[model samples]
Target: MPPAANRPRAVAIELNAVLVALIGDEPQVLTLENGALLPSGPFEGDHPTLQTGLRAWVERQTHHPLGYVEQLYTFADRSRAAATLGRRIVSISYLGLTRERAAAGEHEPGWQSWYRYFPWEDWRGGTPAVLSRQLLPRLRRWIDAAANAMTKRERRQRVEVNFADATWNEDLVLQRYELLYEAGLVPEAAARRPIADPLPGAPMHYDHRRILATGIARLRAKIKYRPVVFELMPPDFTLGQLQLAVEALAGRPLHKQNFRRLIDQQGLVEETGAVSAETGGRPARLYRFRREIVIERAVAGSKLPLSRSS
Candidate 1:
């Protein structure tokens, strides 16, 4: 065995929160350091469970209480800097759903629209202009500049599937971000090569942006099969509000009729015997999510894909 000094040091654990909320027709993520980092802190022993440690960290860092929290993937390999410093950092991330409120922290924390960090991922109208005007052309150069024909073919295949002109799968948010990272098309990967024109989006500190992408991909996928989206909604909301929230997360303009039909068929929500004039010019019916339905089992997917007309 190696001497004590030569042995590997204890791993340092970090807890991070990808707190999500809907604001002004967009899905927003709670961030710190002027929207450049997710709320995170060291996992201290004052907490009993891993989750307790995470909650304390988030509340302390962002001053936002977590609701409907779930464990996100651990990023143990995020230790490039730490490794150089003779330490290992294993980040245990969590996804927390909460309503937006005024942030209270010394860290200049605020809720940033998820799309601002991933402009190409939004397809509410159609394919983002950055995809064609900026990303694909830049990616083409990266492909052509590859060392050999084999690498070029592989790059072409990934770009076609992820940023395709045909149909786009919204759940590929993390995959797309990772592809951009690999192609050095993202600011985070600028160290790999001098990105002439960095892809349109705000870059987060360290690997926090990648962690955010993972959290978003999970939420986007979870909402499709479950009522997880309701966690981010108010107790009473109009069907229109619900649909808008879903679109904001899915990043696609869902067919309204189809979305409402699926929600009804799945028995996900019901009338609260109240109407909201929140939508201008007309009163819309207010509905609350069927809380008990979650206990019984969420029956159907929200049927998120946009049809041709949408």
Candidate 2:
């Protein structure tokens, strides 16, 4: 350990949350200042643990209780002001799942679709137009700008695997964002010059967008094996509604027959015997997530298993 005078300066723990809710057909995150910042506050001594602190802040600010909350990542923000003040600021981030409350309009400023900040990740309809017409062309330029042949080869490989690969992996959210940030393609990057056009996505305050991506990536992966998707769903829903919720988070379309087949095989949902006609044409049967399945069975990714069958 260093001497008293040489010891590290003050450390302040900041709690940040990416409160997610499925709004309409999109996965929206609660934000402040008209959708510019994630909900965050200083960690107080009253809280016992990090997660407890995060839950408190989110619940107080949003006025909506968090259903499924998990720690995502801890980020260190070393701004000039903090350094000058002899302080180190660390943000402990969490991902909270909840349904959009009707009363959000009163307290929360905005609940914008997370895709607004990462448009390239969505492939539910098909490949996002921005990825083909914008991201790819710019990524090619960045690949070509590499200092050496070896570096160019490495960058090209990353692009191929993360972006241009024939099989698009929905969980590469953070990796995709980092590729753009490293190339100064995102506004959050501390580049010497401004990015022209900048890959066409909304930017957030500080490194909040990166934290949001971390949360999204975690969710996209978790829903594959865990029943966390139900946290974003209603008490009872149609097979179509459940599929839409999964697609909203995964950003990929799943085959109706194959997806429902997996749910049946996994015994994830039980029919509530109620039908909803909102789907149009036919009255769809509603099902509720079997809360007991969490302990009764170990779902091997079959609950949300997407074969993408034709």
- Which candidate number has the best TM-score? 1
- Root-mean-square deviation per candidate: 2.0, 2.6
TM-score of 1: 0.94
Candidate 2 clashes: the total is 0
Cand. 2 TM to true fold: 0.92
What is the C-alpha lDDT profile of model 1 across 1-310, one tens digit per residue? 9997799877889888899999887899988878988988888878899999988888776667788899989998844456557678898899999875654655547889999999988888877899889888988998899999999899898888888868678888899999989988888887666877788899998789999999999998898778888988999999999988988898888888888888888888999999998799689999998889678676565657565346
> Which residues of candidate 2, in runs, are more than 4 Å off?
1-7, 77-85, 102-107, 190-192, 303-310
lDDT of 2 by residue, 147-173 (tens): 999999999998998997487788899
What are the lDDT scores of the predictions, listed in order? 0.86, 0.84
Give lDDT: candidate 2, residue 276: 96
In candidate 1, list every pair of residues with a backbone clash: none
**Collision count for each candidate, in order:** 0, 0
